[model samples]
Target chain A: MSLFMDLNLPFTADKKRLKTLLETAAHLGFSTVAINYFHEGQSKGKKEIPKPTPLAQLVDELPIVQGKSRPIKVLNRLTILVSDASHFRHNAAEYRAYDILAVQPTTEKLFHAACMTFDVDIICITVTERLPFFFKRAPINGARERGVMFEVCYAAAIRDSTMRRYTLTNTLALVERNKGKNIIVSSGTDKPLELRGPYDITNLAQLFGMSEVEAKDGVSSNCRSVLLHAETRKTACGIIYTVKTPNDSQPKDGPPLAKKQKTSAS
Target chain B: MVRVKSRYLLCEIHVSDPSKLLLLEDRAITAAVKDAVTSAHGDYGAAQCSIGFSVKYVNAHTGILFLRCPKSSYRLIWSALPFITSVERKGRRISCFLSCLHVGGTIRTCQKFLIRYNTQQLHRMLPKCKTQEEKDQVRRAILSSSTYMLKGKEHKEERD
Candidate 1:
């Protein structure tokens, strides 16, 4: 079975609370979790992107994941709230620090741009409030083609009944547009009590209009693909360069292998 | 004559505070579960869960409970179980969640599964016992529990 992962856990300044959240997540059987740092764009003035906190400072000893003897893996994620086209900077140097990049676009135009052109792993759908615009087919398909996953957060639903209605409504709309493909459900939770087990999240996904297989994928395989998508964003076309160890007696060549291949093709 | 079928759900409630488990009552759990089903699936789920649905057993000390519902609508209730964040008691809510351990068609099968689960838990606890007396006591408990279960089954067969 694929290891369960929660791709979004809202970052908090309180070290104690964050430690408890990580412990609870591991106890609940999530093998991987990401601490999400959110930055909302301003229209007028320049805003500095928030830096991710180092994982070592949060917890001294990582807790072992339940049923998996190994320790839980923690990742840093940055989510930029893009209200306007100018909000998101393309290939910003600051974004490389995060393991995953996500954007929450408030407008249809920004949403389309994020889907087709933005270098992001996940697009967070608005769940706490009424959706300002309808989800169109073009952007949804474009996102799927580009391997960008739509994220539906359930923590808001757990907090209030009104948010619950809005969450289900927006999720159903997204499911309709995408036919339940390339979507992931994550608990953007701030507290340890808000975290649910992976199977529970799967059941909750079914209530969001996904089939059994799709709901299972929402918590397991879909999240794995998103991690891979984020990894590829860090490399050149998903290719990595490795340095030979000193133990190897082979002499270095004049040109790199990739450049040599390109020159030969030309 | 045809017999009606039902599904038994064995669930364990996890509370942030262990003392809050005592505040959980059968009626409160049933109401919370029904409310969750209504909100999650609307009136259709509420209606489906209302029929032949009941809290069959509750053990506050162990935090284990059994829920019974019709075979067809059991999925509706099982899915709704996760949405039950807490049970309200005396104007205050005790925040908790239920983790389902097993689902069985017959209560007997559920009881058997619970026994096996408890035995496994005891074995796991055996290694943590600091004193030899404590270890011996746990071993005795495990053996007695199994024999008691077998004796009860034999008595039931004789009566039948």
Candidate 2:
């Protein structure tokens, strides 16, 4: 069985609260969780993105996951909100430090661009209010083809009734356009009490118009795919370059003379 | 008479302030559950739940309550139960959560199960009681609670 994962846990500076959040997440049986550090558009003069706390520095001992004897896996994720095209600097060096990259597009044009062209691994779907623009099919299909998942957050819904309506309506619209494919559901909550169990999240997805299998995928398989896609994004289409260590004693020129001809023969 | 299948839900209410539990009533629970269903699932779910929804029992001291709904729509009610963040009573807001313990077909079965569950919880907490007096107190509490239920069951059998 695929282990359950919640890809977004809002970052909090308070150490005590953050520890409680992780402990609650572990008790809720999430095998993996990502601490989401958000950076709004750099409309402000300061362009500094907050750095993620290392796992060891964040918690002395990781809590064991419920029903899974092993400790939970923690990851760092960066979600950048794009309002204007210029807000996202091309190849922003600061983004490379995180494990996953995500973008929240505010405008219809930016949404299209983020889905079709952005190099990010995840696209966040706004859930606190009614979607400003209709989710068009072209960009959504492009995103699906590119292996980028659309994220639907449920924490806001849990907090307020009005937001619940917006969350369900916006997600249903997206589901209608995409036929329940390439979607992920996460709790965008900073409070430990606000976070629901992974199985609870799966059931909650049904309120957003997803079928049972699709809802299950929203919590498990699709998030797995997004993590793998983030890996490929770090490398050149899954290729990596390695530097030779000083201990390397192989021939600097070429292979041995005896094997040189055979190398050329191939 | 046509027998309508029913699902009995066993749940515990967790309140930040246990004193506020005194305000909980059967009507308040039903109303809170309706509001939760309406908000989480919308009007359609609320309407479905209204057909066969009733609060069977509430023990404010223990925070355990029983709800019985039409079997087919019990799941709809169950999912929305978690969304109830608080219950209102006489202008006082009691922040709380409804954590489900079990679901059964009859109240008798639920009672039997609750006894077993409480005794097991006692066993789990026995190792945590540091002082000898506390350990013995817990032991007496466990034995008395279990025997109380078993004695009640024996009387019911004799009366039947």
Candidate 3:
């Protein structure tokens, strides 16, 4: 019964607002919470992008709440408008630390690479009402044109299905096939209010043909694993040595320098 | 040097105490060079890949080894039923398939082997070993030792 909450809403400049949201999520019995930041003005085509709040600042404010609570998993949700393969490669490298980077691939090769090389755990193929401006000028009334459009449409449908089965069958298959790679399913919703609960998300999985176990795991376990990885990276910063104990100092037959230190200390 | 097509071997070693099996280090095996070659090149062509004595039994408690061979040189390794001892292969790339079996040993020994080698890759390489006797010994050593436990099959009955 793992619980999760997504904080993809427009965060108020007020610290109190953020605290209230966290507290509300905690009260709602969520074991994890994901924080998504949108590149402001991109939604409206405005040139000015809103500055994102730092993770450290958010962590600092988290302790302000009063009671003992389950650890709320935090993740950064990034949406990229994919125009080229190089763009995805560059962005993936830059945001490698992020838990999930949602991208809508224009081609099957691009999508495959996104999942493979870039380590994209969740790929959100955007379902747009109108095709991108670039596709408009292409020649029509031919089989090639229809084939291109058909592939694009099929890809979108597959992506939607992927989002639903991410936790269940697809993720398991990916894990089985790739061994160490991780795959997570995300709604890729822009608005916080639009974000679905864990149960609803699971139900959506069933609607998309995911089994009950698969649906639950997609939203809970898969997301949990991703969030934990992000948390590990965050906390592991500058702390390389985890083994800290007097007995772990060094074995008697270790390096000469280590033995010398042991002798001197003794 | 036998020119054999690429094949895989899937060997499942079941042990009593898997944890104990995990303790066997690379140095524990007298044949380090053979083990290294087997791990790197696999049992395809002239390259004879095999898991050394440092095999870590992850499911030490349950005493089960789940092996998957995608492709391998020798298919007879599977017939040999090497759940306890060591696997020695003569050629390159083996066949790929899955094998599940119970053996001896603790969860610790299996863990040690897992730590030293790539468990998944090694798991895929088990069935490519040379003889049923060698395979059986490896399986017996893995299953009987007190090292690790088979992850999902902890409560299942042990094979004789």
On a 0 to 100 scale, what is the lDDT of residue A149 in model 2? Answer: 99
Give the alpha carbon lDDT tens digit for every residue of A95-200 in model 2.
Answer: 8889999999999999999998899999999998788899999999999999999999988887887887788899999999999999999988887667776666
**Residue-level lDDT tens digits of model 1 in A1-266:** 57999999999999888988998888677899999999998878888998887888788988777655688999999999999898888889899889999999998889999999999999999999998899899988999999999999988888778998899999999998899999999999888878888877887888889998999899899999999999888888889834457996686777788988999999
Q: State the lDDT of candidate 3 residue by residue for A1-266, as single tens digits.
A: 45554423334456655665564444333555555554321333433323456767855544211122334555555555555665554433446445544455556455555444543334443443332322111222221212111101111222233432332343333333333122233444322222333443444444334466765666566565555444444334436535436865556666778777998998
Q: Candidate 3: DockQ?
A: 0.01
In model 1, which regions exceed 4 Å deviation?
Answer: A241-266, B108-160
In model 2, where do residues sit more than 4 Å from their true spots? A43-46, A241-266, B1-3, B8-28, B39-44, B56-66, B89-91, B99-160
Residue A20's lDDT in candidate 1 = 87
| Candidate 2 displacement at residue A31 in angstroms | 2.3
lDDT of 3 at B106: 43
- Candidate 1, B1-160: lDDT as tens digits: 9899999998878788888898888999999999999987899998998889999999998788999999998878888777778899888999988877778999999998888777765765676699999999999989988897899889999999
Decoy 3 TM-score against native: 0.36
Q: Lowest lDDT 10-mer window, candidate 1 chain B?
A: B119-128
User: Each model's DockQ?
Assistant: 0.29, 0.14, 0.01
